[model samples]
Target: MLYRLDISNILFLDIETVPEKEAFNALSEEKQLLWEQKTKYARKDEFTPAEFYERAGIWAEFGKIVCISVGYLTYTGENRNFRVTTFYGEEDKLLKEFKQLLETHFNQPKHLLCGHNAKEFDFPYIARRMVIHGIQLPYKLDLFGKKPWEIPHLDTMELWKFGDYKHYTSLKLMANVLGIPSPKDDMEGSMVRQVYYEEGDIDRIITYCELDVVTTAQVFLRLRGDALLPHDAIKKV
Candidate 1:
């Protein structure tokens, strides 16, 4: 099925998010209570709200996107090249810029978004953050009345599932199984918040995010029985 689609029409991307505030104590009392209620079922008796705060980035209500790295393929004769660009800095600014990129270039119905577990995480998270920032949802992210078949989103992890509802696969794990290079060589997702807040290094986070996008694109190529992209073929723009 993947082989039937045109690679150039897919925009591969990944996002990095962090809790709205640097620490649990930084949240207002009302928000703190809300967070507590939000996590009660998952935290149970194992950890306090403060102790579980690090995981808040996974929830759109408590987190903010810091970076969104996107990539697309270009062809030159028989060679394929991937160019990746990142939008970072203030969340609102980056979100708007990302929205503009979609509107200006990838607005066609045939254009699709591909990422690992994106349908569950990346796609929805971006849309939620856009709404919170008062930015209009781009056509690709707005799924209100669109039929399920009309949604132009693809998830590598979901494709790997093959309808196995109980199974879950991480991008890193999938890369390993598919013989693609791992993207987590420098850091894991858990360290992103610390790197962003404490180190004040948004560049590092952007690099990490871009690598995930590259890995996802590579994974998709492998799934389609295509050869892995050479290092020289990936360009940062």
Candidate 2:
């Protein structure tokens, strides 16, 4: 059962992304046409490609990761602590560092990657961005030959679904219902592009991303019927 799994073996993470370019006109003509075609149906006639560009961070092909925040638990005797750290700045550099982290420390078969809605978004986005940058995929992110049961990944949203594929849950909503602290008190995902591009607030985005990791970890703990982590026990490493 999930409750029986070791907390220290799971790496909980979240990522913040923004469009590759600050403005739609900044893209090359070829890419502009491609983006138009790619988002044609989604934008319909209601909004032009430029108008829809703000939401481009949802797609890895058009977006770039700005921050990746990860959290993990460690236990010493009966005491436990949750530590978090963030990788930011140049996309390629942060991605390589994150890869090194997985390959070096969390590469064991028993290690699992967990996040809220990560299976559908964060996990694949990182893998796709890594491939676009020509970086070799770590075993945890590379899922080519792994069977369904063999994939060492977990999603709290999927767990909440309880085999109901039709349901969708946001991390904030999940935390609200579970009595976990809200991660969106300061800002929401939709504002990330504005914060990063216009405001030049990388630190704010990193804080938001790290809060998400902590909230996801808390959601997992609540799911496993464990005690909520005290605020003092969470350290930023």
Candidate 3:
């Protein structure tokens, strides 16, 4: 069934996010209280709100998206090529650029947004952030009244699950198991906040994000029993 879908209609993507502020203490008193209240259940009296603040990027309200790297396949004659582009920098600008990309090229009903664990994280996160920024939701991200089958979102992690709801697979793990190269040689998701806030290197993070997008596309191709694109076949634009 996966093989039946057109590769060109699928937009492979990955995002990198960081807490809205560099430190938890930098938040206003009201926001600090709100964070504490919001995370109490998850913290379970173990870690203080400040201690758990490192994971704030996982929540749309407390975080800002720094990069959204996207890729799609193009066929020429008998050769297939993958091209990647990244929208990065200030959150609002990046979001606007990404929205424009979606609105322009991938707005068709048949186009699908593909990511690793996107249904659980990336898809909703992007939608919520768009709302916060007062940007109109793109056709693909706006899932308000759409039926289950009508939502054109593809999650590589969900596809690999095959209905085992209790199991979780990281993109790195799936790549390793499937013989695809892991994207996290320099930094993992755990280190994104530090790299963004302390190191102040968004280019590094964008590179990491782009690699994940490529790995995700490769993983999808592997699932369809197709050969992975050669290194020279990948283009950055």
Candidate 4:
């Protein structure tokens, strides 16, 4: 079934996020108390709420997406090319741009959204943030009534799991085992907050996010027993 699906119908994507505020004290006092309650168990006797604040980006309510990079395949006869684009800058602004792309181009029932570990992270985070910003949920992101098999979404990590619920794999590890280039060569995910907030180097982060999108598409092709994309085949738009 995987081989039968058209690669062009899939929109491979990745997102980079950071805490909503620059520091714990930047949040409202009420929100700070809520944050403590929210992470109480996870940081129990280990790290204070202020200390654990670095990971707040993992939760949509506490974080904001800084970038969303998407890639899709185009075919001219047998020649295939992957074009990548990024919607970035202000959170609400970027989310609106990303929503436009989905509604304008990838709204078909046959279209799919793919990312590494997207089911657990990227997909839901985007949806939640969209709602928070009062942006209408796009059809592909709105899964309120769809049955499990009816959702137009794909997770490379879930596919690799092969029903092993106990198993977990990082994108770097999966790319390594599958012989795809590692996207983390430039910087680690943990540094995104610092890079964005401190260094104010969103261009660097954008490049990193785009690389992950390309690598994810490559992983999908490899999983389908197809040829990996050549370096020249990936073009940033």
**Best lDDT goes to which candidate?**
2
Instruction: Please give, for residues 1-237, the per-residue lDDT of candidate 4 as tens digits.
Output: 689999999999999999999999999999999999999999999999999999999989899999999999999898899999999989999999999999999999999999999999999999999999999999999999999999999999999999999888988888899999775558989999999999999999999999889989999999999999998888888
lDDT of 2 by residue, 17-74 (tens): 9999999999999998999999999999999999999999999999999999999999
Error of 4 at 187 (Å): 0.3
Relative to the true structure, candidate 3 reaches a TM of: 0.97
lDDT of 2: 0.95
Q: After superposition on all CA atoms, what RMSD does each candidate show versus the true structure?
A: 1.0, 0.9, 1.0, 0.9
lDDT of each: 0.94, 0.95, 0.93, 0.94
Q: Give lDDT: candidate 4, residue 105.
A: 98
TM-score of each: 0.98, 0.98, 0.97, 0.98
Across 83-113, the per-residue lDDT of candidate 3 in tens digits comes to 9999998888999999999989999998999
Candidate 3: segments with Cα more than 4 A from true spot: none
Clashing pairs in 3: none
Worst 10 residues of 2 by lDDT: 180-189
Per-residue error (Å), model 2, residue 182: 2.3
